[model samples]
Target: MTETRFYPKGEGMTLAELAALCEGELRDGADAGHRVDGLAALDDAGPRDIGFFDNNRYAAVLAETRAGGVLIARRSVHLVPPGVAALVVRDPGRAFALAGRALFPDALLPTGLELGGISDRAFVDPSAVLEEGVIVEPQAVIGPRAVIGRGTHVGAGAVIGPGCQIGRDCRIGWHASIQHALIGDRVILHPGVRLGQDGFGYSAGRDGILKMVQIGRVIIQDGVEIGANTTIDRGAIRDTVIGENTKIDNQVQIGHNVRVGRNCMIVAQVALAGSVTLGDGVAIGGQSAVNNHVTVGDGAQIAAISSVAGDVPAGARWGGVPAKPVRDWFREVTWVSEMAKQRRVPEVRHGRDDNDA
Candidate 1:
């Protein structure tokens, strides 16, 4: 069954149009006049849908796919099923992505927000300043003295707290909350994102646990994209900073005063404890975590599920629990596997004495 989509279906396109849009060459015998109604994965595609095939591991699925056409690597075109048109490209994934964006332009663009107007159901404080071309959707709340720049869209149920400054061409997604934040132009906060929430700071005293107020802001630089349900806590003192062009995945937890440098890619469920600093071009894999006050140098890559507790040098790859250099981790794993195999005891024969002790 095809998955239900929230966005409206795109207008169907001819195979020839799709090939031109994706910068791919149509293989001979492909029906140029055939229309592709939608995009789907290899396993779920129907006769009128277009799909992509890049990995050889899924060659069986490609062979059975019922798609009208497929965006495929030039080397893998032979794997496509009979009757399926092959659009061969140097980079199949990139070509498919381009085709998807072109085909679903409206679905990819921001919706639900009224351009250059505020919905009647939205509440904007009298003192809040909205520049020209700002869009505030239904049930959105704009707090006092907040400044929203032109071409920004605040989605339904989104909250912009007092004194917040959001820059131009930004899109704050539905139900996302922003407080004590300074966001730069073209920043995209996906649905359910929580920015500037209070940091987990408390003092255990004789009287009881004393909560410390989080007064610092979250500074999101231009072109940053934060994924859904990701929470970035406000600093206890200094500001938490996300640098320009950083892309953070869903459900990431960034603690107080964490500094993420430009063009960093933090994958889903990654956690950075308080005061952690990441240099530019770092890539942290899914479910990994960095301990408090650790510094990851520029261009370092942390593998999935790693638990980093110390500083990582620039251009290094780290992995494993209490993360170490990836090569060292691999060596240790190999040694342990060999040792376990060597220690394995062979089962004794029981041919003559079932009851002997």
Candidate 2:
């Protein structure tokens, strides 16, 4: 016999009612009383599932969907099949995301330790404070001056190094290392993340080598989410700061003394050199590199494979090596192509050839 499993349902939302609640005009007649338990794609939706279609490429699947209701863009509203309830909107993707959050809210973790679970063999300093709802998993070490706030979760084999501070609702993933860092509320450090690591600093004297001291700290503000295996180096003199609500993707390298502003979206494999300053709401594409001491203004977008070498104006889009303005780069490309064409003209080519005589 198969074991029974329970799936939680959303409160007070039916398929037809959800479709009517959307601001877009409806495309087909739909029953407002039918219940929907979750969100799904058009192809994978069941009787109780609500699906969405944002692209016209999936119109065939949308027309055959059994979903109770479908959220679709205004342009795609005509694709809704008969007897299907269509929630028309300008951005179907964003609408779908909102619907998912409403249909399946995140459940909070239960508080306090429970019996029948194996505890880890780890060292927690007597002077350290672990607040309510905090969990320190097996083989994890909490230092003497460390304080983990309420609802914080530290995974197994992770090290909260000496003098570190972690705020409430934060998550430290497995095998991560944090030293002399200040992590804010709701921040997430994924597995294998390395924070506050010693920066590459050294001086070679006439006689021998001199190691430069790194006395700075890593400061991550509230609502920041760091991806797995990313490395954020500590500052050389000041703090390596990541502003609030900034999302960093996996395998990114943030060098010492980098200042990133609020709500920035940094994609994977990005390397920011030391002392780089990025204004708020900047979006950096994957594999982009910003040179040292460069400043990127607010709302600037750096496309993928770009190598930024100078200051970028606010709200501009930059690309290519040395990272010039997109318009200027395109103009230069057009000029070069036109010049090459002019040089290849038969009359011009013969004149230039005879001029050598």
Candidate 3:
């Protein structure tokens, strides 16, 4: 069983209410008035908690789950234990997510900065323009000529540097710094995110490495959510652009002049070197890295911890240190393992001195 953590419980909802909220059909085992007070994993769920089962990998766990009610696909409705209420849906995960949002609305929305308007402790420059309904938290700094649109919230200790153009309904998390950037609407920058920093550029010189002056800006499109501690550097020449709805995970580093297309999913600790271009809908796994100037085609998937050195063709699934197609990589691994198992040890020579030769 999964260990449970204590989260403040919300108002209890009846089985009928949950079914209505999630658009699922409630089976007739449990009473409609049965109260569900919390949501939990199958192993951790109690009589008052609702759980979800989606993946077949956890079939054994599903059979043994103690949840009073379980959300499951219509095909898997028979797997529910006797006495447990089955909420059948097209997608159990999606239904469970909707139920979670309905149950824990406060956990999903911003809390500290939502109710309060601009904080008295925040610093807004006289030349900077903030639209109506913008919320600036305590100790946040807004620089000269910065334009922040309506319904944006700048969290505590965040810095909006000079000449930045932030769009409407954006949430800039605490300690995030943005400079020389044009950000689009509904973007969410997590805590410690640093955007528009100078790229790593140097020129060979007789004296020492001469730093090149970065002149270009960072452009982030709408509906993007950058994770905590992610760093995106500005371009040396052309602008660094992140397309709409790209979901980047925590600790990702995007170098200068990089172009990431719409709907790309870059997992945690992924690194894209300077001038790297990713096409739309690319999914890069955790800890993966692409070399400088590489172009990854649309819909390509890079496996976890892979090092990509060249272009990946569209719709390819690649993996390994020096990545290759999934089939090729698996074949190579199998061949190597077979070779290792069949190899014979070299015959050991009796003690002989090199001087004899």
- Tens digit of lDDT per residue, candidate 2, span 103-147? 665522222223222245767888888888787877888988898
What digit string (tens of lDDT, one per residue) describes model 1 on residues 131-218? 9999998899999999999999999999999999999999999999999899999999999999999999999989999998988889
lDDT of 3 by residue, 182-285 (tens): 99999999899999999999998899899899989999999999999999999889999999999999999999999999999999999999999999999999
> Which is the better candidate, 1 or 3, if ranked by TM-score?
3
TM-score for candidate 1, please give it.
0.87
Tell me the TM-score of each prediction against the true structure: 0.87, 0.82, 0.89
**TM-score (C-alpha) between model 3 and the true structure:** 0.89
Q: What stretches of model 2 exceed 4 Å from their correct place?
A: 1-12, 16-28, 104-120, 204-210, 331-357
| Model 1 spans with C-alpha error above 4 angstroms | 1-5, 109-116, 203-213, 344-357
Query: Quick one: best lDDT, which candidate?
Result: 1
Model 3 CA deviation exceeding 4 Å by range: 1-9, 12-14, 20-23, 28-37, 109-115, 344-357
Candidates in descending lDDT order: 1, 3, 2
